[model samples]
Target: MQPKDWQKDFPVAEPQPFTQPHELPGPYGPPLIGHLLQISSEQSHLTLERWAERYGSLFQIRLGRSRLVVVSDHKVIQRILEQRPQSFRRNCVIEDRFSEIGINGLFTAEGEDWRRQRRTVVAALSRTRLASFFPRLKATTARLQRRWEGAADGNQLVDVCRDLTRFTVDVTMQLAFGVDPNTLETPGPVIQRHLEKIGPGLQRRFFTLFPYWRLIRLPPDRALDRAVKALDREVEVIIRATREHMAAHPGHGPTNFLEAMLMIAEHEGSNLTSADLLAHTSQLLLAGEDTTAYTMSWIVHYFTRFPEAFARIRREVDDLIAPAAALDKLEQANHLPFLDAFCNEVMRLKPVAPHMALETLEDTEILGCLMPKGTKLFVLLRYAATREEHFAGGDCFDPERWLPQPAGHGNQPHNTQAFVPFGAGPRICPGQHLAMLEIRAVLAMLCRNFDLRPVSHGKEVKEKMAVVMRPDHLHLRLKRRSLASSVPTCAPTAMAASRSGASHDL
Candidate 1:
């Protein structure tokens, strides 16, 4: 079945004559350094959102020498994203940083190179491939359930972010390389440790005024160097093992993402290289791990804060997939409308990629703003998504808004064009299907097996941006459901439980 066309229901804005981006309103920054001193790299997204509120949706800001056009207007952002490689390309700094450590891939490639890399990634993560890979995903999730059950049995405080990261890493490794790192069960020098160091380090370099690490390597810089080398070596071993596996089982089609890419490279000689393969393989682990994990973490946070929504989702999971430990078939996941809406709500509030940075490939007009070639564009992805003008009760976490409203609701201004969590148009994330599947499976499993409680010790869960936005110091305490309570309940059982006053677990 085809996915829903979210944008089709919303009204499209008409294009008009252009205006210079520099002519837009913005706050003042210091000389030469611009906003470098004003905004720190970690909380830059928050600063941009505040600035968007003070200034209009479209404005300009200077970060060091680069004067950037900051766009929070979703319509304009969609237009800019849709015109990719041709009119806009990913910011050069992103590619530079990724290449500096030898892991640049589809995320940073441009033009024909990007197109070629995109084809391999798209095919590898295609629906047909993901369907076949469902059993592996289910197996990984079952491992997670077992781990969480142990934690629940011990009444241990679960490090939600760390565990979720491990979960994604394991899933990505198996799905991409057909190897189960099993970070969920075993403890060792995992790739997640290195990734933790790299993401924030890259963010630091991206916002820094100068390349200070080149002249002098600080402790963190030295650590980053080690992490990069370690990750490269790790991926090298996996690549060699994968090649050996393919050699042994020669004639069959690609079983995993790495094999698929290797096949493409072998067939289309000179089109892809060894460096390209390594970079893209490493990129999948990098790209897949953090975003999905963090989003799931945020979902857990939301569940703790909004108990009613949590209970409602648990009810939905029980209605659909209860009596089973986890989702058995891929089609079973498609029946989860409320869980789907709940995730949409979470992503809308706390988008993992809160903003996207791109550079103008040529002179372009966005929302009537004249953007010169090489102009830096910082698209505030979550700003317009949470605004009252776009969504009703936009600040509140209301999953029902995503579900179809009743007929008498009289068409609330739910501007679907303003929402691009996985982005829009040609260069949208290729791994979105896999990401959503992981999210639904894990969330459903959590709701079905455990009751979630927040472990924040009087400190509010705050957003921290290290290339991706994630909650800081967030943790959860999981309570395993009794076999009787965990069973799929018919209407009479549910009503009886409701009447007995034993339905307050959320």
Candidate 2:
């Protein structure tokens, strides 16, 4: 069904106020465990989506001893999301787990604290600021291209996820702190090694019914502790170095997020502390890496499945940026409408964050069901995105739906609200602008310089849950384009270091 036709069948309904919480529709599960075992699997979002199909838009599902109100309705979810920090906040368990690992910053903060920290973060990643950081980002992309070039030349299989992680780590470290740990070229005891352990550890604890790690230190738990301590030591060194730079220059202004945050904390009458700065810094580092890396990885996965889209992007990139190997200007990244549309489709199909967990701060009535205070709500972001009721052939990977059509064409409108990949409303991911720029730069560069061929079979590729959803065991082979120019041979280490001091001229 087309989007215009599906809306007539499924209209966004107003609250009925007649239904109660216990009266909602759901599946019957085993006595004590409820749906814990099935939902605790790595593909929990898929499980919730399947249940959404069976039980209608809204349903109640119990995981272990706790009952959660699962919602797949986008309109309802939007209404609830807009009331954040006041009417609803992130589930306390999420904050508790993140706080335990020392990463509970802007992502998990609430009320006034969230407001203050968000200002600093928004300033750091703002589009104006991102433009100034483009040279560093471009240099990082050039390094990744070099890595792929070597792989293509040797006919070696490229671990797409691992390489993309390195790309993001290199880009993020420079932006987060004014330092370059170019993991793409140098492979040693860097920040990426420690960051790799943090995501899985957090995910393991999030789904576990009880906090067993606190009582007994398992191998993984001990490793997590060591990773945290090591990461803290690294961050402490960065803080000391930044302070010394500031003291020596005296005339120089804050250059990076860490510097900006440190300056804020040092300001008189500011409420933020050293611990708060550390948490927010770690938050940006982790937040910047996985989402964008997994997104590009999924784009590559789709390119292998749909070669026509790959050709289309390559043609677009070739026309737009032919002489240059990769995008040089920040504005050039914005001009590729087709590449942007293609990314929109990829995100719609495989959102890194498929669901967002929140808790009600006050008793609320949604649709017809009354949710009491402290009730857990699972908003299925990807569920409604794939439903035919909101999109035309929603399950399929089609990019044209996101593009503009002639007026007389069958009116297949795109519902932007239904697809909340980065989430919606005030607390939406602040890094979205940065993520999109990074995606455009890297993918455009890939299409321009190489052809992606899948190394793993379709069935062999799995979606494993970590800090965010990622393509597990995904491998690809890149063949350098014959007609395309050779990849840039600039030394990224020097480029990054020279540009490190040249931050956004805010």
Candidate 3:
């Protein structure tokens, strides 16, 4: 997909006049480093949930010297989202980190650049063009299905997160760069190991809460550097190769993102240099992979904990899809009402990016409070979804709440705003549709082929907020439906070759 010609014309908005804010209500911590030491980064969202109950939907919290205005109020989030690329922009820390990485994609870029980048990505993965990419998605899924079959055969305790990570990484590479690195079957788990470092590294830097990240060369930081550099280096080579390939084969362009961005760059919005292409592509790879992978893992975590939910999903799959049917027509996933509600429920319970930080680009009044410019805003996405005002039984896990009521039920309109799994705003995740497609396809296929039984590890599961919200464990056993009843079988392990300097096809 490519950017539309009109997106290039979007104009930057002027800053609004400042209005003095009344003394904001908050539990101000000690001089400077306010609530920084009190909350664990891993369970920060739960802490915010507790605070939301005590301090109301809107209150301030201290994390180091920073005074973060946390908003769990839906109306405030609505106001913030409604005013975008003008009164509100992503936090400077986010932009600076993207800059440090030498790339600014849709997420980090602001003003006209953000609009242009957003158009490029959305078009690339748009519904109109998604069909062409389905084969690549199916290929990777088949490999994952087979690998899981192997694990079930060995009675191995599969790490659902690790396997899902591999599946997403492969699909991302195939769709984003037209490359295939069959990670699921690859020995040594080359790409898996590298992608694993990224989330922990980014989370470490976020929690460090200082400007000396480049100077500190500790394991987490160093590992981050290595992982980022490795990914950047690979993307760069792909970009250059893509450029050469396009030059040699004029009028017949490449299929993935590098080609799409390059083709659109010459004639469209925000004149993108080679550097812009590299940065944008790299950022997509870095950001896209972690969030989708973690979200899928969280879905698994919920299903494992609640057997009834998994059973319902399996029944739905059995009813809708063929017993051993290949999940080829992904568009048909739309017809799956129960599965869709199931996904909605899982995300409501466990959103991957629980907190997204933005800054007040201008003095803005939200929910009757005037927040001045430069105010650090923490959009507590998860908390917003959990507020009693936003959702009934905010803490409970219920998929039926998302579904339409039966014929006998009273008429009560559902509060759609309660679910903000993908955040809200001009910068709300552009990749959400594609993410859901991948999750649904894999999930539909998994439930149809096998029965996933939770394996208790004695310890309760923990939410480790590493960049993305990740479950500390995915202890589940896969029982093949075929062996018990009647059936069939279905691949990227490419980072090793890249590490060894092996070139792959476009």
Best by lDDT: 1
Regions of candidate 2 where Cα sits further than 4 Å from its true position: 1-18, 269-273, 457-459, 484-506
Residue 77 in candidate 1, Cα distance off native in Å: 1.0
lDDT of 1 by residue, 1-506 (tens): 12223334333452233557667788998878989887889999999999998987678888888899888878768877887878788889899988988888889999998898788778877888888889989999999999999999999999898899999999989877888888898877678888888888888899988889989999879998998888888888888898888889988898777898888777777676667778888888889999999999999899898889888888877877767877888977776767777788888889998899998877666665667778888999999989888888888888877666679764666776777788777899888888889998999999888888788788889999988988999988899987577665664122211111111111
Go through the candidates in order and give each one's C-alpha lDDT: 0.82, 0.80, 0.71
Q: In candidate 1, how many clashes are counted?
A: 1
Which consecutive 10 residues in model 2 have the weakest lDDT in total?
A: 493-502
Question: Which stretches of model 3 miss by more than 4 angstroms?
Answer: 1-22, 266-275, 411-413, 483-506
Candidate 2 global lDDT: 0.80
Estimate, for each residue in 375-474, the C-alpha lDDT of model 2 and write its tens digit.
Answer: 8988999888888877778898888776665577545645677888888789988888888889999998999888878876655877787868898878
Candidates in order, TM-scores: namely 0.92, 0.90, 0.87
Model 1 spans with C-alpha error above 4 angstroms:
1-19, 271-273, 491-506
Winner of 1 and 2 under TM-score: 1
Better of 1 and 3 by lDDT: 1
Provide the global lDDT of candidate 1 against the true structure: 0.82
Model 3: residue 482 alpha-carbon error in angstroms: 2.7
